[model samples]
Target: MPFSHAFHPATDHTRLGKLFYDAVEPASFPAHILRYRNNRAAATVGMDTLTDEEWIDHFGRFTPLPGSLPHPLALRYHGHQFRQYNPDLGDGRGFLFAQLRDDKGRLLDLGTKGSGRTPWSRGGDGRLTLKGGVREILAASMLEALGVETSRALSLIETGENLERHDEPSPTRSAVLVRLSHSHIRIGTFQRLAANAETDAIGQLVAYVLETYYPQLGVPAEGEAALTLFKAVCQNVARVGAQWMAAGFVHGVLNTDNIAITGESFDYGPWRFLPRFDQNFTAAYFDQTGLYSYGRQPGALLWNLARLAECLLEFCSHEALTGALSDFPELYETALDAAWCRRLGVMQENPEADRAFRHAVTLFMETSGIPFHCLPFDWYGGGISAQRALASDRAHFYNDPSFSDARKALEARRPLPGLSLDHPYFAGGVPCNMLITTVEDLWTSLNDRNDWQALDRKLAEIDLMADALGTRESLSD
Candidate 1:
């Protein structure tokens, strides 16, 4: 229920497996522990799809995935809280509980973010707030649905403990966020080894990442083989960045420690998906400088990769490392082009068509901003019929003079990249649902005070349209 899709739990995740129930309650990050009722996602992960009674059974329970003991692991090192060399931060509030392959063979980490203190917690309570968990779950699910490559939120439980931070008005409660990631290794994993002059461990970590995450890299485990691993990580990282951009998702925090070697979306702290296109948009309250805004994410990813590349240089030559980074722009553009093509249902690169789609998107945002900017996203998504019909309603756009840009953007014909008569992603496309008014009330509803839930509930009713829309894979090129 807390995740994007449901399946029976595979087996207890076995990687560097550690079990918990006797949490130390680091008491510094005092988490407001909340137990998630995991009937849906837990089952999918091959765990005991819990019954209410079973849920209580699992909590404070640390049974390792079958046939495994506490798997050994060391946190990779790096700078943090901005550029400070904090070589001591590793699973501060949480630990990697288990790692398992999903039915798709994608490895997902069943790690807890606010589980409790680890050796590196720095005298801080490892507790998470209930509110913190809630926000992360929402952010993860919504992003996944929108086709962004992100770590999944398995289950979240409020720890029921109260937390007080300088930012909260009242005491906050913590929640246990069961994070599903491709790998638990972070950039810090590499940095820490580099810091300690443990080149051996650094190589070991690189080998582990390659064997577990990218055996396809076709490189050996030692020597320049490490450079090859770096190249693969760069590709994955760059593709993820493009996904975030094409979908308007902002991770908010891009600390080196959060950069998984697998380049999957790992930490979900202070993240948000922008409802409106604003390059300067930021989700974290403390991110005053907008360091992790929508537009800046790609640069941040590249910056983190640079850090990783530097760390790897201890083993590989700079010439090789620098060469690896060169692959970034091409990889990122390819991902963006693919995503953009999918959205438009076209694959051939047609500059004119792309320009038109971009224009339409720009105009849709301008018009949509006048009303219902955040809630329903029918204009960008929904059925084409509904979307095209709503465009005729001048009242929505006319209210804001700037909204006219949308009209011009749409009217101008540019060869659209995905405008092919048969792109599967848009094969049976229908218009989006922007208004709740009975088929006849689009004009009035545009002017009415936006009622979000009215649209949200209606969405449930319209899911049938998805079936009517037919199989999406059929649109695949």
Candidate 2:
């Protein structure tokens, strides 16, 4: 009841009509134990002041937020799973619970994962393992700190239930996760409309997206609107793809349904950070072919964008769509340059110099066998960190012949002005890394001893890293 003045709630998605989603009820859990609550994210939507009891009533029991959605909506969508078209795919375990404007006036959705089964629940129980919830929190936190546009794990509550899962040890603890993201619309949302030949619905969806998310484009003439939206989404997908690469993140599942139409990364399932710069690194155990491997992520994004472009064919010219799709490589390259510069804490030079420097760094990362995070961590602030890098425990890795070109390239670039290299985080022997081993260890402590201290400590370290990199505040800006 203590909503802040900044609170602005809207049920905009409902305007799309019953055809877009099915209103559903949340499952009644036996118990509600608050596991994690992101006050920083909750503050954005003016719900930070809520007591833990109120938080449970709202997020856990699905008691509707005032002036927001009355009940959850299981959104309908279709997507390609590993290049195979699956018409049955939709929000089986999750639903859009609420929509409200953040402090910056951007629309944010409070979506639930593992709240309960929906109409799309194909047969399996729609529950999420507690371990799965923890993994998502870790992935989202780390990606945000690394400057990736990602969803925030707003609330994670351990529901009093034991669920059986084949992937993990059976009879795992159950939890429901609330993710805060800019939009829940996915590329597959369009795909579903197109597949059904619902051209009128597609037009309405395009109008809604442009008006709500891409207002900068304004109301273009009907003929040009679809193409303009396609172009903008293309640019967004390209930039996010490049950001993922620079962050050394492998999203594991790059399915079209998992890709947000707003370009923000959400649905952190089976995601992993690179331990080393191996192109073949993959996150999912079931990803036997590595279709969504680290190196293939950009191509996967482009492929999904093309699928989106196909959905617009009924409204836009084929030639124009193809031309827009072709621009991804260049847009991605430009974005990568900017992302790498930001991560390394350097000012970008001329395009040629930036390209050469990136190439040199890539060559060294691939051949020198140094840990992927070390490159940016050691060379952060560019030439200014030379002494600090040289004295680090991993200095011998940098002395390898393969690193000479990258070392020279880094020294030639200037650090961004006003970077606070004196931060205590940088004084450590190594940077904050979220390797698989580290994640598993954190989970082990929690699953065995119910000890949250390890996870809490890691979150603190991630916050410190974000502060040092200036990513946390910059993302809100």
Give the per-residue lDDT digits (tens) of candidate 1, residues 1-477: 422243334323233223211223322222223344334345545554444444432333434444332432224345555545676677677776655666556556667777676666788777676656655655554445445566767766555566787765447555666776667777876776677777776666766677677866666744667887888888888877876775567788888888877777757776765656677889688888988888788778888888888888778888888877887877776676555434432333465555555555544654466332221222323233234435444345534566455444333433333333233323334333322133224212322533334433433333333333221223211
In the range 1-477, model 2's lDDT, one tens digit per residue, is 577777899899999998899999999999899999999888888989999999999989999999999989999999999999999988999999999999878888999999999999999688988999999999999999999999999999999999988888988899999999999999999999999999999999999999999988878985898998999998998888988999999999999999998999999889999988888999899999999999999999999999999999989889999999999999999999888888898899888888888888878888877889998999998788899999998899787776788889899888887797899889885899999999999999999999998889999999999989999877878
- Point out where model 2 deviates above 4 Å: none
Q: Give the clash count for each candidate.
A: 59, 0
Per-model C-alpha lDDT, please?
0.57, 0.91
**Candidate number with greatest lDDT:** 2
lDDT of 1 at 450: 35
89: Cα error in model 2, Å: 1.2
Residue pair clashes in candidate 2? none
